[model samples]
Target: MAKETLLTYLDEQIEKKLADFDVAIDWDTRNHTIEVIVRLYAENTNHMAIDDREGVRSEEEIIEFEDAILLYDDQKAVFDEDDYLAVIPFAGKKGMQQKVIDALIMYLPEILVKGQDDLLDFLVSDEESIFELHFSPDYFQALQADMTTAKQERFLPYPSY
Candidate 1:
């Protein structure tokens, strides 16, 4: 199957699975990856309708949690830190599309509700799984912010200055 075909299938499946949420899927040709962005609005309120000074004033706010799922061909020639997670090995393989779809259906909802850390833990524990997980700089920042402890330790060691 062609890459475009795979992308279309993924889009359709993701849309169906996450019908309640706002979803956006993009195929990154340069990186050979599909980026899925899911957004869930927790709160949406419009407190005010009109005001004299502000013309059309309104206290409208939406609290949304936007998460991403990066799916890339694991059998790529070159590898990078940013390109690890949700491995879709379509290289000389059949029935890989269904496997990918199954993985997405199982994990996407958890990622939406429990956040990225849950997936990180799962990928770390399941070494035999096709999916690979690596922490990015943004992930570390989010992890640190989510931590409740007073002391925050660095996930990766840094050199002394």
Candidate 2:
């Protein structure tokens, strides 16, 4: 199949995975080689929106939401303009955690490419495609919301870790 078709296939598969959330695939239009990841996020930015004036922020609200963030627009006195996605304290709700896990599970049995020499090489190699989009595709990677815990664990092998 064509690459565009495959990307569409990726979207189509993710679209059908759940009923409550949206999965957006941000393709690396610049690199176009060995750069592919599917990112699924909940529409929490709007839900987590506080008023134009500063309002109370819950500890849970501060932790669970991590997509777009409230930017301190100097021109205005409020922090409603969110152009950042920062990683602060990351302890989320059980349901939010489960949704993230479900999305990962929905795509775990597949890869974007095949013929990986090893885990490290597979992680580093540039990509072209040759695998089942639903099964184990040849070259691809995936990301979802709330992977901070997983990311922290993955870096535990480093000296600085």
Candidate 3:
């Protein structure tokens, strides 16, 4: 299949897995590569909104949520923006943490690509299924909203085994 066709397949497969969340995929035809971005989130079901703000939840929960977004390769593991902050505190730097976080966010797409290459190879060999989309923008958006609103609803059902 051509690159675009392959992307469609991957996107559909990812959506199936993330039916409850949002996902976005960017395909770079020039490089014959795809960048997948997913936002995993929970909602704030509390009856009252906090001073017009969304709500609140533990930062640790966010870390756990991101950690659960698994890929076939370890290199493609999901990263939590907050969890990375801990390392900076341990390093005793204030502004340094932001820099580190910025670096990770900037290169996240490339990191995912490394993991996807292996996954694509496996899927091609398997022949049982064809994966389409490489990323979920909606998922990423939800996560972004979650961070911005600081509201917590329900945990995302863990990715299937």
Best by TM-score: 1
| Clash total of candidate 3 | 24
Mind giving the per-residue lDDT tens digits that candidate 3 earns over 1-161? 53223334445555655454444665433332244545433332332122211235332312112221221122232344332211111121111122222232433444355435543343335342332223344544444444432222212121211
lDDT (Cα, tens digit) per residue for candidate 2, span 1-161: 53223234344555665333432444332322111232222222223332221345432222122122111212322222232221111121111132233334354333222211222232233462221123222221234443456532321110010
- Each prediction's TM-score versus the true structure: 0.46, 0.25, 0.25
Model 1 residue 149 CA deviation in Å: 46
Candidates 1 and 2 compared: the better one by TM-score is 1
TM-score of 2: 0.25
Q: How do the residues 21-134 of candidate 1 rate in per-residue lDDT, one tens digit apiece? A: 577886666655566766654332433232322244434454334445666556542445343333433432221344444456545565565544443333335343322223
Arrange candidates, best lDDT first. 1, 3, 2
lDDT of 3 at 38: 53
* Candidate 1 lowest-lDDT run of ten: 152-161
Query: Candidate 3 at residue 88, lDDT?
Result: 14
